[model samples]
Target: MAGGFGAIAGLLGRPSREPRLLLVHRLDERDPGDPGDPEDPGAGPPRSLLVTHPRAVPSESRGGHTLALAAPLTRVTNAALAPATNLDQTPLVRASRSMMAGLLSDLDHDGRRFGLGIDDVLLSLLRGIVLEHPDASRTAPPEATTATRLRAFIEARHTDSRLDVAQVARELGISRRQLHRHAPDGGVAAMLAERRLATARDLLAAHRALTVAEVAERSGFGTASRLRAQLARRAGGTPKAIRQAASA
Candidate 1:
């Protein structure tokens, strides 16, 4: 009986080391140490449970290709492990756990050549789990929708010299105080200035023909001197230097 108990303990104690591959056609398996690197991993095998963030593109680029966007599982793991017996009983959690168990069993039986369908299912499960994670308050801001909308609106109108806190608040259909709630970091004026500066940088980089005054006007700085001052303070160089570097 002592020998039997020792064998049981050993069986239960082994770390799971089964190799797994992602189902995406051209993405390679992840190396955990360098997992967060932005370089494309290329078509190789897949590593299990590696989360990667891909940049958003224009609406035209949404389909007919395989892509994934996720942060590392470690970002939400602690929150997921929080003691929540009541949450565990929820149907969503129960279903996710059941599906995960089935996936694991299949991996053990079929030796890891999972189909794309399996990957899609697994990714959906992970997204659900991350969104419902209890410690999300500490992990990511819960008011992301407002922040996203605010940023998108700002990007669209950063070229308007009249784009101020009042304008932003009007565009977002919220009061200045409500907008402040969305941006707790530096406040509305700072956010607007940052967006305008970013627009100025993009303009300077893309159009070598545009004069400093033109770039300044188009980027909503209204005056070349103001643009120069902003560049000196925030961008660390003259607009001419920025354009020259981009051309080179």
Candidate 2:
């Protein structure tokens, strides 16, 4: 199941009550040949920066590197300058820049009031880099294997009520079994159910004007009864209860 544009727009229109950002900076060279750990006075220091929201951390080494910033777009909603290196010397640099540019463009164009869809942008960038980069074999992220494809499929059809395992498999040109194998245990059906529930929950929490049945239909549940049953089973609350709580 997926969210409708109206539901998504409503979620986007809300104020930035919860703003989180994740900044990841990995050393271009994972295997630097210094056996002595610097902190231990025998091996070299590990190079990485995993910073959380609203926090800026400084690094000691000012080496040429690739940086990925994943944050809620509201914090930096305006067009901002990001550093880019020449990819001709380093192929990964070029791939990273291309991926980032596509994301920034999407943010500039389609973002709602609170922020851009950074999660969707990041997912799209990762998928493109993994599938299209020439040297993907050398530096591709490990999680880029199945999760990326699954995410791409979901994002592509996040608004379509008819999206199911069969439809997804047909579009991706893979077998149903292959799609299930790509997903975690309990497989595609379970994943789809979870996504639908999450979308419904977001809408319920944010949109006071929408009815329970409207949210259900918008989030891709076939009928209000089915939505109610699923919400009760998964959330331990009725749709009406959830909506009331949200309003309260």
Candidate 3:
């Protein structure tokens, strides 16, 4: 069980903050030995520890390849217990496999390898699950659509100095209220913040010539102070430090 979990974690890129334990034996075979018999169920299922944050996995990438999977507690339990069973028998498992195959196909189409880093693979798996089985109340919720639009908006205006929510709403022909409605969970501001910070980190790692302010602006943060605060809070370092580390 540990080996399986480790393999999946390696594929998905486990985050530093979460505590994850992977059980390795095939579900159809004997017990994996390290069953997570936590004393408390209210604390959350063992799998919950694997994905505590929504952005724990990076959803989009320059490589244009990602896969997502979300299995129901029951399904996950079954899979963990019996690895030899075909996941397709269950709706969640089938959906997850389909999503993974599609992602792999996209990567293959783009002439990229299907192999993804752990974080990306993990994000892809969860995305597939959420997309296929949103909560009944969240049915038709604008999250997926809004995320797509926001991603497009970010990509288009990655270099713009005035890339605020208002402008993004205007460009998308939607009011700020409507955009906010589309992302009620975190709203546009949170999404943009995450996107910009991630982009800034990527740029800092990739380019030495770009200044901190330049990286901030290009990444949609608008200012170095905002970027710095965000980096300190979420990325745990100053932009300069991130760049310096990248260079080193």
Q: Each prediction's Cα lDDT score?
A: 0.53, 0.52, 0.50
Q: What is the lDDT of residue 38 in candidate 3?
A: 55
Better of 1 and 2 by lDDT: 1
lDDT at residue 88 of model 1 (Cα atoms): 27
Task: Show where candidate 3 strays beyond 4 Å.
Answer: 1-147
Residue 134 of model 3, lDDT score: 28
lDDT of 3: 0.50
Question: Pick by lDDT: which candidate is best?
Answer: 1
List, residue by residue over 1-248, the lDDT tens digit for candidate 1: 01222232232234433211111111233323445556765523322222121121222222232222222233223122221112223345445545655655676787776543464466566546545644422333465477766765665466678778897888778998999999858897777778778878887886667788987887888999989998898778898888889888
Per-residue alpha-carbon lDDT of model 2 for 1-248, expressed as tens digits? 01222222233345664332333333343434455445554323333322232212343323434345444422222111122111122344344454554555666788733322444456444334333423322333465566656764564454456778898788767898888878888787777777788778887777767777777776777577867888878788887787778788
lDDT of 2 at 95: 44
Displacement of the residue 179 alpha carbon in candidate 1, Å: 1.0
After superposing candidate 1 on the true structure, give the runs of residues whose Cα lies further than 4 Å from its correct spot. Answer: 1-144
Residue pairs whose backbone atoms clash in candidate 2:
36-42, 36-43, 36-44, 37-42, 37-43, 37-44, 38-43
Taking all chains together, each candidate's TM-score versus the true structure is 0.41, 0.44, 0.39
Alpha-carbon deviation at 157 in model 3, angstroms: 1.9
Model 2 Cα shift for residue 125 (angstroms): 19
Indicate the residue-level lDDT of 101 in model 1: 51
